[model samples]
Target: MSGFNTSGVLSVAPARMLVPILLILMWYLGRLHSQYEPIVTSKVSSRLEEARKMIPSVKLDWPIPLAKDPRAAFNSSKLALLIEARPLPHLPPLILHMMAVIPPDWRFLFIGSNESIIGVSRAYSIKHQQVIGKLDLVELPPPWSIASKEDVFRLLTDSRFYDEFLTDVEWILKYEHDSILCANSETSVDDGLGWDWTGAARMGDGHFSGYGGLSLRRVSVIKRVLSFQARFNDSEPEDEWFGKRLWVLPGAKVASRFDDAIAVEDVYMERPMGYHIREGGGSLDKSVWGDAARRKEIFEYCPELSMIMDMKLERQRCPDDDGNGDREMADVQVTTAVLGEGDDAKALPNDAESAVLPPQPPPLPQPWKVSVTTFGSPLRTGID
Candidate 1:
């Protein structure tokens, strides 16, 4: 106290007052906390506010499981392939129908040009098939061409093609736009899985007659053939080129004659699994489709052929024509009359032309009628 002034005098009594003030502040804060606890913990009544509170703090995207992928359920080794460059009108429906009728285990592949790929992929059903993995539409890149028949032939004959694009493929069911499988066929395609190569018969009695329009082929056997043999460009068709060697290839089970035919092309059998109408029936085998009864049977058996083949209604036939391939020759009597005198009168053999009775005009000449005898015969036998 002697060293300090009045400002520095001892203040222990003031310090003693701080404890009560601190206690009062702590008690007031405790009251404030207790009073607002219910409001902070109360359940929200507004739906939007509740939803906001329930939402995840961090955003995330997850995939939903809907339809099953078809590839998981089917055997991808068995491939049904259709290679086309032109976008035909019937492609979408035809492809869908084929998928429906073929074994469910089989997967389909459509290899086409850009235009053709776009043409078919536009269909809702086709898109659905692609989504389900039941089908795939592909357009090959450069150094490969399918714009012509010869180009396709070259493609099938190359071994690199199989290695590059057809990995793990064991079998190939090749079909064209003009070809169709009979939904009513008694035999399913699975029955012929044993054969290395089988298709439409070219000739009734040929040693090797497996036409390629609609065919089932074993990839192992094809690869075996391609390993040692190479196809000449633009020479023989791919089917025939392979067929000739496949027939001779030891252990190869190639279809021969009409007995083993898988489809109907030039030769007719009781019931074929399918039909390969060349040019969509424009070029038909007479022995197979010429007879009226035979055509009726074919149409009755596979009415789906009408989907791709060009045909006329039965009522559209000529009036005097018969159901048979031949048309009946009808006798047409044409009459003509002439007018004037001398040479003009001679021109008209009718007696009315020579008569100068009242000054009446002569009748017009009638056009000559053509009598068609027999219709041209249909193609009997050839390679597809």
Candidate 2:
């Protein structure tokens, strides 16, 4: 019995060895998959962190390669005003009054209903033929039979609109038809940036709040938003469409109250730059805001424009008569060559809206020729 037991004891050695061997194999396979995780994971984490610092908006899934700011194409062409024109008899005055405060050189795009009564006007210095103030009007069909809510999208996603009008335009200042700039609103605050680098925390829903009806938008932000149009139902409220798309847009942002995008809700701040003259409450009734003192409170916000309205009222702004004369001038066609993105040129249809001027550029031609940097990594200029 002792002899039999000694032989069997040797068999136990293989079983003991098998247990340790299996453990070693399992550990080896796991390490094969994750051996580089610490190093790779750290690299990925740092890149993601950098992207966050660069774009503090919604977090991106992956790091964006550093490149020339698409915004740089805007160059000096920043801060375009997109005024929504309600079909009111006073709209021309309102547009003129708002344009008075705006610098003559800055871009202004007025969007109105298809049957809108907006007139074409140009302001020029009498001393020189050079045009001073100008406004471009674009009219589109209402998304709803009567509602103006969805009109912004027609401009937002329509390639022809961008090609013909907004290619060089950046920083859209959207004012609902009834909203008007108040007296104390600061025009200097709009440096055309839609981001806050200072990290001052906002109290409310940030830009997801539809720029609160009077907000400035970065051109680059909206172009990115255009790609997501299909995901949304156009029939829905335009603000809801923008909110859902903008919420998910990785690097898109609009300036906030601190930047003077607006601060109507700020109890700490006494006044907002503008007020919406809604039908029920804040209607654009002349009796309420007709006085020089009252209107001055609304227009006096900008020193440069202190007497601009007075100047406009004193004398009419008449651009030089067309060579074809006033009557024929009605049919006088103006065209501009589409620049920058080639897609824009091709996207423009044969219709008059997108056509370049018949033979010459308009009275004041802003030829927007932007050169994109594609080959090399650009120097890291701080996102201004």
* Best-fitting candidate, scored by lDDT: 1
Q: Per-residue CA lDDT of candidate 1, range 1-384, in tens? A: 124458986545666678889999999999998998776666444656889989889967887665565576668689999999998989999899899789998999999999999999999999999988889998988899999999999999898999999897899999999999999998988998999999988763487757858999999999999999998887988988888899889999988777888888887888789999888878777888778987898889999999889888886666555686566654444346566666464243333323222224558887766554444775344332
Each prediction's TM-score versus the true structure? 0.71, 0.42
Clashes of 2: 9
The parts of candidate 2 lying over 4 Å away from their true place are 1-76, 82-86, 113-115, 118-133, 139-148, 157-160, 186-189, 192-209, 229-231, 255-268, 280-384
lDDT of 2 by residue, 242-312 (tens): 56676566765534334433523221223455544344233333443444555565445533233222233
> What lDDT does the true structure give each of the candidates?
0.84, 0.48
TM-score, structure 1 vs. true: 0.71
Clashing pairs in 2: 182-298, 183-297, 183-298, 183-299, 334-357, 335-356, 335-357, 336-356, 336-357
Model 1 bad stretches (over 4 Å)? 1-70, 335-384
